[model samples]
Target chain A: MKRLLLFVPSLLLAAFAFGQKAYLEDPDNFDPTQPTKILVDIKQCDCQRLLGAPEVFLWTWEPAELPASDPNNNGSWTSSNPALAMTNEGDDVWSFTFTPTDFYGVGADAVYSTGFSFLVKAKDGSGLGGGGCDEDKTENLSIKPELPEVPVLVVAGFPSNLLPQDVFTLVYDNSQEEKVSMQNLSADEVYCYASAFVDSVEYEVTPFFQVPNNAALQMQSSGDGTFTLMFIPEQFFTNVPTGSTITSMRFVVRKKVYLGTADQVDDPLLVPVGCP
Target chain B: MKITLKYFFILLMAAPLFTACVEDDTPDIGEEGSKLDGINATWRLVEVNQQDDVSFTLETRNISDFLLADGNAPQITFNSADKTYSVDAKGKLNFWGTEGSWTFDDDVAPTNITLSPTGESDILVNLTATIRPVDKFLQIEFSRDCGGTSIITYLYKYERAN
Candidate 1:
């Protein structure tokens, strides 16, 4: 019996580490004939999953900044209806569906493409009160573009389910031959800050920029550049429940823009939320 | 055989007493100044090396025009005993006249210690001090923000207040 108990925990850990199912599909070859759509499916057997996952996910649009009404409706396909409740689909497959909106936004036309990703978790039975799950856990799905594709930029990695609270480290690498500039947007949450690579440089602005919560380091590209940005929680949103452990984090890096211009409003690119 | 077994049982039961006595006799093995717990105490930001040979005061109040415009001062607190410190986590450590968190990298007894700001890559202050029994004074070199060393040096002295 004692051996069985140990076995159960080991199995549970293995399951947690490799427990969830996640994938993204965008029809094949940018199919111009059909509306460009990015589809996502994630599910977990664990019971204590986080509730009220963020629905609105945004990413940097090409050409950097865009008008308030995105000129090119990058063929969005995600529905903004509502988060669906988990159903017992056979042997415990708690699932959800995601449809990505057009790149140009609500309406417009173009190849409408930019690189982005997602953060997800296995549903443990905490908030639901099933009592048979672990709630404080997180996972991520990082998507990158290969050669011939435009550079895959990293925005901000923040917590979506502001439960217990969270800390994150974002690594920015400027391996490209050309120099690149970066910025962060914490979605108007003060105290959310980003600390760019260690101490080589410092970038501070009045009214913290909307990049990541902890972004302070800035630099012109040194050859083959790499930077690690860290995100530490200084406080929480009003909606977050007290005593709830942060399960995961989410945020975006609006597209990078030249600092010399007055037109700096750019589309923030999305990435899977991460927890460190 | 039964007597021998009884004696074995008694010895086994008394083993803990012997071990306890031995442990009591052992001395705490630690180096001269390597003990963090002994040196643990509250430290305030005494002074910092700033531009134009100016010695910047470390206040836990919002005093900057920009910070006041934004509302708040750059305040820093150092509690070495607890191994924790606080800086403006909003990526605005510079507004408080410093960068990131403060680190007590190494503590050398008799007068030398290395401290650096948290989240910074370059070295900030390499302090050489005169460690008196009660009055400790140190000469500090500050790093320039715009790619050069501070022409002037800032000195700070502390007494065992706590």
Candidate 2:
């Protein structure tokens, strides 16, 4: 009888560990004091009751407890307020944007020290599954506080997260270039050698040397030592076979005319492609 | 005397036939006002409702105050005489472009209006009512379809501005 009790608890723990996951939209720039969007994937959660709910709300009690003075927190497990509702991001993923300091009515120091602990759930979380405690809710999720830091050179534009068919822009800041040879490069002479891994096989989409037909691969100057290249992967990589999945892409920026090895700017950037 | 009585009964029966044939009062097609007449004026967006078609739930949000505060609300004008429409979005939320020509699927009681924006393909927009002037309201619903299934719908409600 004692062994049966021990086995049941262990099974529940295993299920909870493998359930839902959460990701920050901009993890590299995560700052507790600034507004940030957090995405939660509830595809594997035991919340069958929330599958097609018109709205979902965040229920949090960790990092710092919800203050009674906070207007958005209604302080009821059975009824969640609409002010804390999350935006549906399709495909069972939901996102909530909030600044830690203002959301919890707490100081930045407390937020940085404690981080976040929360769960996605329906407004009315009654009679949901897992013996009522787990119904219409995702497993407890947490995010450790990390100070925001400026990236060395490249940063993604618009949708920081990318899908294969989406139009993505890679912004290159010449001022932040770390390599001594690539620093202070002129924006007007910038070009990119683009390639993609289709179904795990590498295929060059643009030639390393400037060609008449590869003019589209040239990065456009956005002024102030910044350059950007925006293209749709499915459209830009014409060599990729149709119906084949693009797993990731690689880019190496350089001058139009390569002068030995010093003309290449920065290291090759490899970006993983996300599922549609 | 018998022949005179029989003629009186026949005349009484014929009186009912004359009443039925007295020219029906129903108006002809062109004589009645066209549906375009009600939709010819300017309209200002007041509210937007997003509906989850799969869930069959609607979430309504009033944006009239927001638009007023921003001072850039989208206003659309329809010209019934020329079958043309113009939108003054002022760089705001607008589905239709700056100018377009509109036509109804059925002129008498149109359920949809096909808007052909300048240099753009035709877009069929569903109408909530056969826009009449007395209604003082216009509601248009459109859906975003993914893989042949409509995932969500947006209902834009507008009030007659001019």
Candidate 3:
């Protein structure tokens, strides 16, 4: 009677376990056109067979259409999506990083209506999708360019270098002024200031120029996004004696320009003013 | 969500793990007295080499003695970024005087720097000082051809300010 009582409870427990169906936790909305989409998810409903399983394996296919029917076999898998299989991360969550090309991007011109899909199985031979009933899809479809590259600021023309003369003669109209233009410069955020070296101290020569609202900047009509700053030193000296020779000078575009030469992008050209 | 809990537990375990590994091994990128940054600082006269009528040799004296103990500290502040250099010179070093524009020769590497008066006060002459940036200081060699072989070579040693 004691043995029968234990056996009856075991039979009832076995009957209750057979009703739990295995299924994949699929993403509700998935677009197949993003350049790069990475996901880490996927849990099995009935994972009792995979108990203590060290890792799980995933079979993925990309740039390929969804299979017509549910696949119950494992031999029909390819590694087109860069990853042939993925081990379970934890909590049944898996990792999937799609190739930038597999998605239907605007630049691709080729439409891949159906994105990549993959099936999962435990390394211990346990079926992932409802015990082999469904497949999982990724999210996001972007038709845009792969990704924008970082912009680089290019400085051209002058921090107009070269010391032409010893005395900075205020020619009736021509004073030694440097014209420095920047390419691909976003002037809205980057404020430019002119810097000159007199003795050993670096003075903000930006005030000497007739700039836009005390901001030394003037954008050119070159559609290529170029900005220029004219640094003319009329009252270039402050509290100094007369007939002072101007030494080297350069232009910098950044916030808090005087926070020292560090963390600032300065034009490489130097104005070597000559003594006439 | 299960994911949030997993990451939270992971962050908990990782919090202490990473705390012990927190060590900033970044290289010191301070470029003191190199390139243009070399001359960008207040130059205080620290040492001097007084030139006599003898050979190219001159008398050596710290700035304390060169200024005749006058406490009227003679200093040529090269605020180069503003294109202005102020000078409060006294005694034999009367030429620097007040303010001026200090320039350096660039055709070659900048070893020659010229100090020209900026304000109405005209400098006796356009003083061109030779600059040599040592590891932590800028050594300016100013020479005046008083007459013939009686050239005065004033070696002005300057220490950099922060």
Tens digit of per-residue lDDT, candidate 2, span A1-276? 999999999999867654547767777887667898988877755545567777889988765676657775745767887788899999878899988778887665566667788888877776544454457777678877575453555533323334565445666777777778777777667778889997669989766765324788777776887877876677778898888988888888877778756877556887777632
- Model 2 per-residue lDDT at B127: 98
Clashing pairs in 2: A128-A135, A129-A135
Top candidate, metric TM-score = 2
Candidate maximizing lDDT:
2
- State model 2's lDDT: 0.72
Tens-digit lDDT track of model 2 for B11-101: 9989999998898888765554568888989998777654544331132323344244465567888898999999997655456778989
> How do these models rank on lDDT, best leading?
2, 3, 1
Q: What share of the true interface contacts does each candidate keep?
A: 0.00, 0.00, 0.00
TM-score for each of the candidates: 0.20, 0.37, 0.26
Alpha-carbon interface RMSD for all candidates, in angstroms: 20.3, 13.6, 27.0
**Global fold similarity of model 2 (TM-score):** 0.37
Worst lDDT run of 10 residues, candidate 1 chain A, spans A157-166
Model 3: per-residue Cα lDDT at residue A157: 32
Q: After superposing candidate 2 on the true structure, give the runs of residues whose Cα lies further than 4 Å from its correct spot.
A: A1-147, A155-158, A210-213, B1-162
Q: In lDDT terms, how accurate is model 1?
A: 0.34
